[model samples]
Target: MIPEELLLKYTAETKRFQKDEIIFSEKQTAHYYYQIVSGVVKMNNFNDDGKEFIQGVFYKNQSFGEPPLFIDVKYPANAVAISDSTVLALSKSNLFKLLQDNPETHLKITQSLAKRLYYKAIIASEISSQEPAHRVLRFIDYLKDDVYKVEGKYSFKVAYTRQQMADILGLRVETVIRVIKSLEKKGDVKISKRKVYR
Candidate 1:
């Protein structure tokens, strides 16, 4: 859990955003590191052909903007809210101040960074050898083990859309849809009204 003082400081600078609202644009200077207090945010990049690719989805309690904070650079991707969201923003200077005042906080951030690196490695390994369907299955397993729960045949509180899932898995949207449908046919999973059950 984050420290209460840190939470208070963040709450003071936090703001609310509605669905589809652009939180920040690509190449924009990263002045603030944000922690999601509620809802979801998607980070994406667009190629020269204007084809958009999602980089990641950040859900509640997740922290982002670390790349910019560490490099003292602009954001490499744009961030947009996928639903009504409330995010706590801490300026670079303020964050540094907090870290300076609390060495433990800095260590905690380092641990978080290490965990992210480990997860990234796993994602790369899985995407390299798995078929699209298997990729989706592995992703679901990760979600179940790391993010949420699977009770009987139902999974609850999934925070990603099909497109976002495709982006994370490095698969095309149509491929994702087809793989999901195939899983449904196999009785491995089910999709109803955009909710997936396994």
Candidate 2:
């Protein structure tokens, strides 16, 4: 992610958003490079019947909704504050200038986008052909092996709620609950004090 000082140097504004506020909607122009200063944000889309599909979740220090800046396309999903949050937003032109002035930062942004693309490809495959149990387990494994880098059994505490998991994985909430219980029985995960660990 771009450093805070660099963002400030580029005249990035620190904006605050309340919980559930829409930062930008789907098809809106991608005029800013946003980095989280606090709290959580999610990029998502809703279906005709109002079912939510989470594209990604970002926490403090992470960047979201930048892929469109590189592609010159409008945002494909809406960015919303999951909690009251502060974010730094740099105009697209300012971002270009900052990147031109810092080749290393440009490379870093490219690498970050590539990783997200890789994750999308992996999840897309899972949603397309995998069973509910397999999708749930693989998603957990992705977080364990890639995101958190935790290895030992039940060492990673899951932070997402069942409904959030269902949205992200394109499954029903009931399915996620059942899958978690099934994973527990299969020794694939551990549920303790109503918290899940993997």
Which one wins on lDDT? 2
| lDDT, candidates in the order shown | 0.80, 0.93
Off by over 4 Å in 2: none
Total clashes for model 2? 0
Q: What is the TM-score of each predicted model, taking all chains together?
A: 0.83, 0.95
Clashing residue pairs in candidate 2 (N, C-alpha, C atoms within 3 angstroms): none
Over 1-198, each residue of candidate 1 has an lDDT whose tens digit, in order, gives 346458667443878999999999989998887889999988898878877788778888888767788888889899999899998888778877888888898898888777667667878888999889888888886777654546666554455677878888888889988888898899888787877776
lDDT for residue 59 in candidate 1, whole number 0-100: 81
Alpha-carbon shift of residue 111 in model 2 (angstroms): 1.2
TM-score of 2: 0.95
Q: Write the per-residue lDDT of candidate 2 for residues 1-198, one digit (tens) a residue.
A: 788999999899999999999999999989999999999999999999999999988998899999889889999999999999999999999999999999999999988888888889999999999999999989888888887689898999988888988999999999999999999999999999988999
